[model samples]
Target: MSLVDLIARADERGLAASGLACLDRCVPLLGGDDEVLRPLWSSLADGGADGDAWGERLAKARAELDCADPSADTVPGLGPDPASGSGSGAETETEAETEAAVSDEDRAAALARRMLATAPGDPCASALRAWADACSAAALQIHRLLDVAADGDGPLVAAERRRQVAVLELLAGRGAGGLRPALEVSTEGRRVLRAVVSRRARGRS
Candidate 1:
């Protein structure tokens, strides 16, 4: 099915299931660390940096995942390399103000721009970028469905979409070679997501 059709079906179903499935499919297709790393690393080189709260939140999330599964590695958005050199996880109070939260729309736009820029360069790069754009657009739509679920709509649909995104990410070949950390970050999200989908599929209420 088309991404939009999958999204619509997910929305009609529920949150915790459908949305998660979409992400499984989407992230691999459009999301990952190394791609973001280049831009983020460049941005840092450009003198922009993240804050303490941001780092701490990431650290904490990583720690929690680590405790649950020692084998997992950090995802791109949450993974910060100390070797890149800025400082400890601590952010200056002012830095906190400057570091904006990563929004779904912002990510999607960035992907679209990257896709456009990369498409003319090389065949593989163009393909990857195009896939990324598609995934990002799909993610934004899924995020909207999640917003609806948060407002008391279809939880199962939300879950399914998320899973689909993640799965698509894997299928797109972006999720390979990062088994440990990917598994860690994706475990809980995947678990909850699957449960929701399975329940819904079984016609549970």
Candidate 2:
């Protein structure tokens, strides 16, 4: 099923088959190198008391699936070349490997899981959901601001000018939330748009 469906099912059934399906997709979707996958996997490893009963078997499954520790250097196929037992093989790390090595999203997922585990009620879910939402909003806001700056002071100019300072603040990393960094990075994009338009406007005037 889709990710949203899987999450909903898991909520209803406490890690039901659908949830497992969602988890199964995580490796491919996040890619094997995603650091965020680790915490999700960890949260699973922490498992409900019931899954914990399966113990080592569950752990083995997680490892085999490549969701156990995305940051692990033992990636399949990327390992030492068999013939290169000669030790002369190029040891370049692929983008996938690099991503897996540092999946920052992992920590956020883990924190959400821990909070959810303690109180499976609306309060816990809402709090974590808010964090995710905030991150998404910050990212989107950055996009809008950049678009306005890039396209010039057109229809968006008025609205952008109003929110311009707020957008700048977000890019400066003054905001606090799960998605703050992403918002911050988006700032550079806004900067590009602002500079281009502002320069053009000045020349015209």
Candidate 3:
């Protein structure tokens, strides 16, 4: 099914996972490490039945990610991911040149931050649906902004679109069982964005 249709038809847990996965993949733009949002993901794994834990985890993730020094958001080698339940591997992104170029990257990062900031503490259906849709749009924009190749739907953006669709589909089909694979997809995207950010940072230095 199309991503929009899948999201519209999704249940509360599906909606929450959809949004979390989108933001998780874009974590690098916020300068958060891969595991920084693991707590939030864990809260979703049980299908968000525990509203209290979800809220607490959401607050904790925000606290860690909103630090002034984004580079040090998470420990380098954290324990097993709450979502993945196993070891994981990485992925890369794009950047522009002076003025406009730098603006594109900054804009991308800002969009990513907005995604994290706007995440609902309550995890209600209405709130999650809206947040999920917004995250989807922002994540795509971030990829387009940083896309090294400016061609129509560069690989970065294209892959992001696919990942978004895949996340929703996984949740739709496997329900709670889908969170693991959905998380794996987001994790790969996170590594890719980290590489892109790293390469761009190097170019500036």
Candidate 4:
């Protein structure tokens, strides 16, 4: 099924996991460690959306990551990175070239931060649906901003889209059992994002 259909059909746990997976994969942009979101995951495994653990963990994560509560548009109207289409992610050979590259990264980071900030403290089914949908959009955009393929989405964005689907499918098919594999899928994507961030930093330098 399409991602929209999968999300619409998902239960509370599935919805929460879907959104968390997206945010977890984008943690690299927030400069957070790999395990920063683990607590929230654990809360899910131990009944996250139904308790205070998710909220506490989310709060702690925001503080630890130093996610500033700034309004969106950190790069004002900085929309999709052209890299997702015909632009390239490897054009930073000088300060002048780095300007646009840095702006894309900054905007990507801003989107990531907003995902964390907007996550609901009470994670109800109603609230989680919106959060999940927003996370999906933000994560996809972040990947698009960082994507380097010359033709289309490139490997990075393509893989991210696939992983998002896989996470939802896992949750849909396996129920709670899917959480483990969904997390695993997200971890693999996180590693990919971290590598991209590292490569981009070196390239800009």
Q: For all the candidates, what are their Cα RMSDs to the real structure?
A: 18.8, 17.9, 11.2, 6.5
- Candidate 1 has a TM-score of 0.27
Candidate 3 residues lying further than 4 Å off, grouped into runs, are 47-50, 67-102
Once fitted onto the true fold, the runs of candidate 4 whose alpha carbons sit more than 4 angstroms away are: 68-102
Best by TM-score: 4
Give the distance in Å from residue 126's predicted Cα in candidate 1 to where it truly belongs.
Answer: 2.3
Off by over 4 Å in 1: 1-123, 143-179, 202-205
lDDT score, residue 142, model 3? 82
* Clash pairs, model 4 backbone: none
Residue pairs of candidate 2 with colliding backbone atoms: 33-100, 35-103, 36-106
Report the CA-based lDDT of candidate 3 relative to the real structure.
0.75
Error of 4 at 24 (Å): 0.4
lDDT of each: 0.35, 0.33, 0.75, 0.83
When summed lDDT is taken over every stretch of 10 residues in candidate 4, the lowest stretch is 75-84
Q: Evaluated with lDDT, which candidate comes out highest?
A: 4
Cα lDDT, model 4, residue 135 = 84
TM-score on alpha carbons, each prediction: 0.27, 0.21, 0.80, 0.84
Worst lDDT 10-window in candidate 2? 112-121
Clashing pairs in 3: 91-192, 92-192
